[model samples]
Target: MNTTNNIVPAQVIALKKQRVILKTETNEVITVNVSKGKKKDKVFMLTMADLLRSGLWIPVNRTLRQLMRYDWLDTPVKSYAF
Candidate 1:
């Protein structure tokens, strides 16, 4: 039940009642809750939704801002702390 540590490729299936259902490569599915907010916030949410839909998951410790800064999504994680 602890799926947080599981590394699985997931794809978005549908959205209902503000939740996203992700179907993994193994056929396992998980639903993630999404928040409804203003248009500004929706931009960020949509980006996250796209990532999930593409079967990519971001680590909890990293922020979207950091990812945007280094283009790590298309590359690899680089240490920016120095």
Candidate 2:
């Protein structure tokens, strides 16, 4: 398997009702998760930190480009490895 990565720019926006959204230039809303025990910003930042630490954060540009050349979309959510 080939493992490569890239980064692209995106805008992180907060919505009402404690929801966090990631909006791309193309107006794509990638993921939306609600804030649980912390502030919206804190939750979003920590979630991003986890994603980055686990190598699951992929920029939207790279995501779309890779979709054309790759057979599978990159997984940004942690998956069970056991």
Candidate 3:
């Protein structure tokens, strides 16, 4: 079985302290941690590992495009282009 096929597409709806809220294409909402660290630090972008662990997947192309639109997110679009 291909695990990738089970991955669901979701959009970042809101950002909270060390957490990211996402709404799926099917209208399901999910909350995921931004970092695995202990400190209460700020996070700019979500990592591929974090998304996968949270059962979410945002395509690289869409991530790059959205990165531009969500300027508050710190990081170059090229980083997600991969």
Q: What is the lDDT of residue 49 in candidate 1?
A: 63
In model 3, the worst 10-residue window by lDDT is 60-69
Q: What tens-digit string does per-residue lDDT give for candidate 2 at 1-82?
A: 3334334444545344554345556666654444465444564457554544554434443443321212123243455354
In model 2, where do residues sit more than 4 Å from their true spots? 1-8, 40-82
Q: Put down candidate 3 lDDT per residue, 1-82, tens digits, no spaces.
A: 5545345567667666666667668776666554555224323344433554666446322222222224323456777755
Model 1: which residue pairs collide? none
> In angstroms, what RMSD does candidate 3 have relative to the true structure?
10.0
TM-score of each predicted structure versus truth: 0.44, 0.31, 0.43
Q: Which consecutive 10 residues in model 2 have the weakest lDDT in total?
A: 65-74
> Measured by TM-score, how close is model 1 to the native structure?
0.44
Q: Could you give the C-alpha RMSD of every candidate to the true structure, in order shown?
A: 8.0, 10.3, 10.0
lDDT of 1 by residue, 1-82 (tens): 5544454445566656666566656665666655565224665557666765675654321111122223544433364454
Clashing pairs in 2: none
Could you arrange the candidates by TM-score from highest to lowest?
1, 3, 2
